[model samples]
Target: MSNETNAILNQVIVLLNRSLAAYLADAVPWMGRAGAEVGESLTAMVKDQQQSADRLAEFVLDNGGDVAAGEFPMSFTALHDLSIEFCLKKLLQTQQEAVQYLQQAVAALERAPLAKALVEETLGSARGHLETLNELLAAVH
Candidate 1:
């Protein structure tokens, strides 16, 4: 892989990891209480996001790039005590940021076709999750 692609992948991995940490630290604990419809959707999103991150990591390894373990920022843990709606809103913002980040990555990777394709898939997933979160937030309100 090119240096540019590798660098973007690193950012994406970190972002995904942080999102996962936020979910596990804050969202998962309250998913059940979030409401029947929203809870079910959140559960599916959490699982899908995990699979997406794993696929990206495996892609990095298959391309001979080292896959670093992902870790969240320390302050994310401080958000654990917020309301379920607040947690979901925060996750939604994170997902939106990831989608935008991936968009730029895909654009930058145009010359690296394989990397671009992988990033596009992740972007699509992020968009889907973002839409779901919007609906969930509506339900919450």
Candidate 2:
């Protein structure tokens, strides 16, 4: 894999990790048993995101590059005051954005077939997350 491709994979990994961390931190306190199912679903999604990041990091190492972490500043104040419906909407939007990032990473990694495939798989997972969030959001109203 080329350095460019490695960098793209690393970028995607960092973004995934950052998003996962933010969601975990912000969503947990609000997720009592009433939100237990969704909380469990989010936990599973976090695990998947971590696994994806690990795979991307391994790819970067195998390709002779250091993985650079990506940072996203989280402002939970606005979200803190929101209702469950609003919070779910925000989460759904974030998942959609993650899917878009993974899609772009897949396109950029065309030369690295394995990397591309891994990213595509992660993209599918992100889409599934989006679907779940949509269903949850619909039930809110």
After superposing candidate 1 on the true structure, give the runs of residues whose Cα lies further than 4 Å from its correct spot: 20-22, 25-33
The segments of candidate 2 whose C-alpha lies over 4 angstroms from its true place after superposition are 20-22, 25-29, 76-81
TM-score, model 2 to reference: 0.85
The models' CA-based lDDT, in order, is 0.75, 0.76
lDDT of 2 by residue, 1-141 (tens): 787887788778887788733555555546443476666666777887888889878878987889888766566455655456567777887788888888888888878898899889889988988898888777656
The TM-score values for the models, in the order shown, are 0.86, 0.85
